[model samples]
Structures are given as C-alpha cells and as structure tokens.
Target chain A: MGKYYKTTPWVIPELPQSLKNIFKKNGKKISIRKNQVISGNDETALFSNTEKLIYIDSGLLGQAYKTYCVNKPYAMSIVLPGRMVNYLHYLEIDNSGDIILALRKSDIFTMTKSQFDGITEKDLKDEMVRYCKKAVTSDFDAMCCMFTCDTPQRLAYFLKALAESFYDDISTMPLVEIPLKLSYAEMSYIMHTTIRTIERLLPKWRSMGYISTRRNSLIIYK
Target chain B: MGKYYKTTPWVIPELPQSLKNIFKKNGKKISIRKNQVISGNDETALFSNTEKLIYIDSGLLGQAYKTYCVNKPYAMSIVLPGRMVNYLHYLEIDNSGDIILALRKSDIFTMTKSQFDGITEKDLKDEMVRYCKKAVTSDFDAMCCMFTCDTPQRLAYFLKALAESFYDDISTMPLVEIPLKLSYAEMSYIMHTTIRTIERLLPKWRSMGYISTRRNSLIIYK
Candidate 1:
C-alpha cells in the first residue's frame, strides 16, 4: 500500500510562467499524518494560519462533516493530489462545521492571503478564477451524483471518480487502482447506508469480477 | 398569493459608488415566466446571449436537476431576490444536466461578459469574488444539511434557509415568511423523499406552531 502511495506534484495546465514563478517562490510545503483533522471543530480554535491557497502535493483529503446526531465525523468531497482546497474558507464564505481532513499521510503546500492580494496581474487573476470554477463544478457534480444515484451506482461512480483523480491518462489504463484505504464503515457513511449493506455488497461485486481488494487498496477492472 | 408575489430589487451592502455606477450603466433588466428553464439541456442549445452576471431583482429561482432515472425535473439551491446567480455558468464551471429555472414569475438584471471584463477596478473584482464565495458557501451548507439531517429536520432547515434569503433582517424577524410557491411534490424532490411523506409531515408541523401555509406562501415562526 505504501509503495502505491505516490503523490503527484501540482501542475495547472497552461499556467502563465510569471504566475508560476511567483507560486514557486512563495508557497510553503508541509506534511501531515493519516487521519489528521486539518480544519474544523476543535482544530479551528488552534487554526491561526494565514495561508490563502492550498495545493495538495500527494495523498487523499476530504471534507469532514459534523452532524447533529452522528458521534463520529464522516467525510465526503474527497480531494486528490494536484488539486487545490480551502479557497472558500480563506475567502470567509464557509464558516460552517465542515472541516478538511487528511485521509492518508499527505504532503501539502500553501500560499498566504496577502501574497494573493499583492498579485495585480490580470492573467494570474483569470487563472485563479478558472481554478476556483473547476472546484465549484466538482462540488455540483458530487451533489448531483449523491442526489440521483442508488447506493451501488453511487459507490461505483465515486470509485471511478477517485481513480480518475489519480490517473493522468485514464484512457489507457486497464485496471484502475485506488490507493487510499477506505473502510466499509466509511463507505457506508459516504453513501448514506448501513455497514452491513456495504459488507454484503463487496463480495458480490468481487464475485462479478468488477472489483477486487488487496491490502488497503481497491482495483476496478475496465 | 398574488399580492405576495413582490419582486425585491438587487442591493449589495456597502457597495462602492464607482462600481455601482458601472453596474447601473451596463446591466440590462429582464423578466421571465414561472417554470422557465434559464440554462442547461435543450435550453443550452437555445442560449445564445452573452450575459455574465444575473442579479435576482424579484421572485424565486432554483437549480432544476434532471436525473437519468427520474422523469420529472427536481429543483434545489433556490435563489431569491437580492442574491446573485449565473457566475458558475458564466465562468463555465457547471455544464452538467442541472438547469437554472424561475420558480415563480421572476425579474432579473444581467451584465454581459464583455462588460464585466471591461472593468479592471480591483474593488469590483473583489466584490465579484465575494459574491461568488457566498454562492459556494450556500452550496456547501445545503450539501451538509442533506447528508446529515433526518427528513423532518432537513425540511425544517431548508425552509428556514429559504426564509432567510427573503428576509431583510433575519435577526429582527419573529416570523419569517417564504414567498415562493413550492408544491409538496417539488419539496419531496428536493428533500429526496416522497410527496406522501411531505403531506404527512406538513400538518404535524402546522400543529406544532413551527410553520403554517397561507395560499402558496409558507410562514415559519422563529
């Protein structure tokens, strides 16, 4: 599992050279442990960092949701490497109970709000808008899938999306490999079903030759 | 019900005078009929205009979702007067089957994409970013409520949020009124439940003094 846990570096296609230089110079890199709460709840009181932009260097991260009745926190909006996070919170739009969490041992990079403010270049601003737009689209896509699909189709869609996030050339891959170790309990929470349901479904899927598991990873055949 | 169909004008608090002047000069006001599809699906093919920003001047609007399995369209993320819309589509972020629709007879003001691009003022750009961030926050809040809350709580939360969008000052209101006419079927679709379930719950809610319906409007006692 560790051998498969490769972190892809962040790269925005067609990014202007000047903006890339600024990002390279100012962004600070950091490492986090698996299952760490990055932002929200009690962690928010200690969260005084001034970073405005967050780039995932490697590993899985997701939005940790705090519900009124649920004791354990559940995660959704799972993010992959080479993607960005925290633009909404940094902009002060989302002040709700949702928190960012590390799904696995991860590497991340950050850019301060002030650093973002200092950039007056039109091209850079346009690029940032494009990136933010992509994040919003992804949110809507996940919301649509959750609302429309059944548990099995939802699980399959989520797994395929996760695989696509990791695979740069998904068109050529024979077997899509998901590196993160997601438990049946977590899947149940994400899919809004019981753990018993997920446990019952996994073996059935395996028998159909649609999916298989090894160690902490899942592989879906194309 | 007809008397309650009032359209409020767009107003962003503490907006700069200079930017306001630009908006006043460039924005074009228009009206749309109830149940009109504003964007997405077949409407996208007919969409030829280049408007970049849509400010709800009066009436209700929502994201009309078309699913693969469902025959009827469902709506969520309901927008009210004084709120902004179309930034995601204008930025080309959302291109799925979700369409923006007029929930009631609606009046809106739009600024062309070129007109928006013409403004190089930093304050206006910041203001636009702030508006977009608010929309994103609303999406996240709705998603969290849907995932976490039970059916009754979810319906209550949705109604309260809808009222807040119409209220001038939620802090001072004893009873908040939702001005839109949402059918039980529509509510069921948005809540991911059956219309029978909504019918069963409404009378119980009215008896509890939490909510009451008059004609087409819903009044929520705070």
Candidate 2:
C-alpha cells in the first residue's frame, strides 16, 4: 500500500526573507494557515510575490475543485446575484496531498448557477473536478511533489511564476489601477480554513512586519 | 467663479446591509474601494462581485484624455510595467461612475516608460482636461458632474448596475457570488486608500453579519 502523507495543518515559517524584508519596510507581516488561498489565476496577485505555495491549514484542497467554460479565458464567479461573471476562473494544483477534483466545460450551466447560489469552497472544488479534471490532474500531481519541499520554498516558486503571468508593462499609461479581486475570506476557502482563523494569523504577520496592510489590501514584501 | 469642490476621499464601506445579507447566506464578500477599479476590458475583473462599484473618494473622473492622440476615458490611474499594451487605448466612462480603462487596444510605444511611470492619478485627470480643452473648457468641469456624488451613494449605484450586468436570473440562485481577481493592495491604489483601512473595515462587516468569506470567492446575500 502507498503511504499517503497528508498535508500538514500548521502555519510554517516558510515565507522568504526577501518578502519579509519588504513587508517590514511596508509595515506588515506574514503568516498563513491551511485552507487559505495565497493566489489564483485571472486575478492580479497580491504583493506581486511569485513564490507560489498553496498555504493550507485545515481543508482538503485536493477535494475542492471548480471549472468554467468561457467565451475566452474569463473568470466565471461573482459576489452578487448579477449578470456578469468575473474572471475568477483558473486554479493551480500541485500536490497529491492537496485535493484535485475533476470538472468539465460542458457542465458549466449545470454548476454555474449553483456556484453562484452559494456553493461551499469544497463544493466549488468538487464542481471544478467535474468540469476540468483533465487539466487539473497534472497540476495536482505537481502539487503533491512540490509539497515535499518546505512550504515556503514551494510557495516562492509558485509566487514568482504567478507574478510573471500577471505583471503589466510600464510603458502604457494605464489610467485605472487594476487590483487583485479575491478577498481574504475566499482565499481562506482555497486554503481550506475559516475566515476567523485566517484573520487571526494576519496580526502576527503584521507584528512581525512581513506584510503591510493598506485599507483592504495586504502587500507582501518578499 | 464656479465653486470647485475637491472630491472628498470616502473609503468604501467594507460591508453594506445588502452585502451582509448576501454573505450571510452565501459566505462570500467582494468589494471595491472608493476610486478603486473593479476590472478592465479584456483584462477581466480581479474578483467577481455580485455587484461592483468604483469608490470615487474625491477627484475628477470621465474627462476624455489623450495618450497617443486618441481620446480615452479617465478613471483609476494604474499601469503594468511590461509586455505589449493591451486594450488600454480608450477609456470607457459609464454614467454610473464606472470607468473601464482600456489597455488591450492601445499602442505600446505611445509614451516612453519614464513618461508613463511618473504619471499619477492626479496627473491622469489633469491630462484629460488638457486633451479635451478644444471642446471642453477644463478636465475638472467635464468630470465634476459625475464625480460629485457621495462615495456610498456612488458605490450603491455601481453595485446595483454591476448586479444587473452579471447576474439577473433571480429564480435559480439564492445568493450571488463573484469570482475575484485582485489582491487587496492593488485595490487600494485604485480606490485611493490603503490596505490597512480595508482590513479594518472587512471584519467590522463580518461582525455586523453583513458579509462572509469563501475559499476563492465572495458570497453576497440578495
């Protein structure tokens, strides 16, 4: 029988020193628990830190899957009962320990309404598996492999790639400042934890100066 | 002399009653700060909100401006630092104070990086006036009418419209969830505020039972 090593359920001091430096400079701190999503596709990454690691404390991310069918690479979730689907689509899986549910594009209509209705983060992941199983399996495998490395190291690699994917060039005089759209609560879901639990750890980071808070946004400095 | 009112800076409330109801039922909350951006054309919203509002704290908006000699909308002031410029060529000024700064359609070489880099939100609005002076007297005058509403009212209106724009089929879904794509910090720049402020307010709403958190999205009670 293959030994199944469960993902740990603690907030490891895996954040990079560079990020800590920046966070301290900006007057913030860093600490992540399980069931917390650090980043996602189709959104501007927080702090532009490219070290990617799915910070999980207490939920089965492997079991939480979501999928979407878009006219283009558009996000398909919304916060209210409205007509437009924001581009919160695209999930990155990289661990056997992390849950990876399958999803199909054709089933968008079947799941979209429910997704909009108030599906739990776990349910969302389950629906995603039903929608895009093929695309995620590989990522899921990678996630499991990556988790073997210290959490911070894996996170560092993941974050750097994420930053490269979304960083916009400086030449264009962009009149509007586009922001990363996910909230701390939703992020907590991806990481598989409670909002209170996630919120609880933030102050620790703030005290350590590994992160900085500006109104609603948290700037990661590494 | 025309009475010039500098737009007062109003931070968007982290939770509204409507948002609270939705989050309580759905377990998610998606919000935008005053003067912060929700999304852009082709770029997708950072996060999906059941409804979205551009928190206009205090500043002129909707004055047509020129970058590469083309008239464009002026709203949030932000630009990515690399890669080819996307639909940023024209600015879309909505009547409800929602502005989409186009980047996909703009030319990459229109302005040198230094010129673009140094431009601030104030500078962006000023350019609009300079660009439209031939038909418009000043940037301030053209944008003043739309920028005069209180931040809460403006936010309310934007949320209503955003709801209609994304989810209108009320029969099926009980709550609305918006997929988000932005980080908290990026949102601050768009809203003309800081992340600390945002952090302080979100929990207030959660305590008031106005909003809830999800793993990768926000749920709003309709």
Candidate 3:
C-alpha cells in the first residue's frame, strides 16, 4: 500500500487564488499547532455559531469517514493550504463529524456566514460551488480508488496525493516526490488498513530505495 | 442480504417540491424510456454544447462509480425526481463518464448553463450548493456503508434504498416495503457483486416471507 502512492499520478488541488483573495480581504485568520483537532457536528467548530468559510493558510488537515463494518474510518479528504475544510457545513445542507486534525502546525482563516454572504458575488459563488462539488466528487473517487485498487496502486496514489497537498497550487502532472506529517499508525489510519500492513510495506519500500524517513514525515525518493 | 433492507431502517429521499417548482416553471422537460443511457465525459450529454441542469420529473436514475480493482461500477447514486444531476458538470469543475441511465421511463428537464446563470439568485444558489454538497457527501457515505456493512445489513440498506428512490421526497425513516425496478443481474450490478449471490439470497428471503414479486417490481413485506 505504501508503494501505491508513489506510482499514482493523482494530484490534489490547492485553493484557487481568486477564492483565497476573497478570504484574505474579508476573513479573520488564525493559526494552530500540529495534532490539534478542529471539529464540528457538536458545538460549533469556530467560536461563532454561524456557518463559516475556512481557508487553510498552511499545513495538512485530515478527515475520515467510517462505515458500520469497520471500526476504523477511511481517509475521506486531506486539506492542504488554500482550501476550505467543510463546504457542506458552511452551506448548511448537512453537518458531519468534523474530526479533521492539523497534521502539521496550520494557519487558517474563518469567515462567518454573514461575512461570506456579504461577499457572495455571483461569480465567486459560482466558483465556490464548482470547487466544493469537485472536492466532494473527486475525494469520493479517490476513496473508491483507495479501497478497490491493488495495494501497490493504492500506495502510489496515497503518496502522490499526500505530496501534492503540500503546495498551494493544484496541478495534475506527476510530481517528483515529498512527506513528514505522517506516522506508521497514521498511515494505517488514513489508508484504512492495519498498522501491521503499514509496518510490513515500509521496510520493503525503504530497502528498495523508494522512500525515506525524516523527523516525522515519510519522504518519497522515487 | 435480501432481508437486510427489511431489518435495517434506511430511507432514501425524493427530490424536493421547491426545486421541482423552479424546474417546472423555467426548464424544458423531456421524457426517456427505461434503460436510456444519459451520459457525460464524451460527446455532450445534452444537445447544446453548454452544460445543463437536469431535474428528474419521474422515474429512477442510476449512477455508479468504478475503481481499479473491481470490473463493475459501485452503485454511487440513485437520483429521484426534482433534483438536478451532475452539478459539477453544470458548474464545469470535472467531467465523469456520465453512465447514469433511466432505470424506468424517466421524465426530466434540461436547463442550460446560461439559463442557470440567468436564474442564479443569491438565495437559490445557496440552496443549490447546499443540496449538491449534501448529495455527494451522503451518497459517498452510502457507498462506504455498502462496501463495509455485513451481507444482511448490506442487502437491507440496498433494498430500502431501492424502494425509497422511487418517491420524490427524501426521508430517513425505515420503509415498509416496495420494489420491481430491479432484476437479479441489475441487482448484482448495483450492489457490486455477482448475480449468483443475488440468486442465492432471493429464495432465502422469500422463504422467510420477506419479499414477493409482482409483475415487474418486488414488493417487500416487513
């Protein structure tokens, strides 16, 4: 599974500059350290009770969805810099168990429902709809790919997507390589497999000169 | 598996009347027979080069997602009346292999991109965004449930969902029973399993006095 992320050419997108500009101009910004859990579906995720537009300034934010059969949740989405965390929550169509934690120290902005509504020009709203729906659609596609793809293909995609999430720019071309905001346990959790599976795959990939380890992140050399 | 829909309480929603009002008042309506394939990601799904908003007027619509491992596409969404199909395509974010077909003789309306933009009031756009995001989120959750739930539970959810999709109103309560838009082969396709499995489950469920056949649809008796 670890090897699959290397071979997969799938690239996750960064938030677009236009949308970023809207947030920067009107949204309140804040920062949080790594491992902090930013959640919803109980009390408000933000200090405010209104719906919000969240812009990730930096760092990795992870979300997972669980089903009845498995005790573990499958990694649903990974938010990198320049994107909002929960558009559905903001839109108020549904509220989900947020449980998205900052994998690294993260900088983010929160624009309340009023602020977002005030800035809701038709063009911007159109763009937001496009981005949010695409986020949900492709994220589901990725999950489908993850569970159904062979271990090798799954690992390749997971790594490529992980590396791609670091940049503020969204692209589709294959990346050269990057990782650190992951541990073996986290990898198993994100991949929705067992720690034993992650442990078994890491050594083989490491010996094959496919990946390396730093302080906390796994760097793909391949 | 066949009995699960009877045991578990899961209900699919029909399209809302408000949305239906918007489509009925402003969009062009057309009808297609059962099994008609309505597609995207290739030649235009609509005659116009521009994107269009689709509102199902009547009958069931089926969409499936395929991954690398499985040869079959998983039952992704079953679209009922009043709601729009492929909002991402309408919004032009990403295009998928529009494999959604009319499961029954479906009457639907097509509102062009320009038409949509023209009618895009702020409140309406917000509602649209909310609806689309919720559709994607819960639909993905449904897939997660399908793949992860035990066979009995899996079949239960599948059948209840199948029945609920026939109506235009979306609900979450458990359904009493209904069926007929499904064949065992189609059941295998939607459930992402073998026909043999469908064959194996039907009789056991029948003997248990759970389901019976009408002219076309299966009627569930809880």
Residue A43 displacement in candidate 2 (angstroms): 46
What fraction of correct interface contacts does each candidate retain? Answer: 0.54, 0.00, 0.49
Error of 1 at B102 (Å): 2.5
Per-residue lDDT tens digits for candidate 1, residues B1-222, read 011112111112222455445555677777888877765565533242234466666787776555454643454666666666665554455555556777789987777666776764776777766656555555655665565567897787677556645665666788887766789877886776788889999989899998888887888887
Candidate 2 off by > 4 Å: A1-222, B1-146, B149-162, B169-174
Could you tell me the C-alpha RMSD of candidate 1 in Å?
Answer: 6.6
Instruction: List, residue by residue over B1-222, the lDDT tens digit for candidate 3.
Output: 122221112222444566667788898888978876665433524442235667788787766554445465454456656567766555454545345667789998878766765776877766666565556555555656654565566676777666555543335434344645567777776666678888999888988888877775677775
lDDT of 3 by residue, A1-222 (tens): 222222122233556788888888878877878766565533424432235567788777766553434466444456767777566555454545345666778888878766776767878877776676556555556656654565566666777666656643335433334545567777776666678888899889889988777676666764
| Residue ranges of candidate 1 with Cα displaced over 4 Å | A1-29, A44-52, A67-72, A89-96, A116-129, A169-174, A189-193, B1-26, B44-52, B66-73, B90-92, B117-122, B169-174
Model 2 reproduces what portion of true contacts? 0.00
Return the TM-score for candidate 2, rounded to 2 decimals. Answer: 0.21
Candidate with maximal DockQ: 1
Q: Compute the lDDT of residue B34 as modeled in candidate 1.
A: 83
lDDT by residue for model 2 (B19-99), tens: 223223433223333343334322343422212222222222221121111122223323221211111221111112223
Each model's number of backbone clashes? 0, 152, 21
Question: Isolated chain A: TM-score per model?
Answer: 0.76, 0.30, 0.77
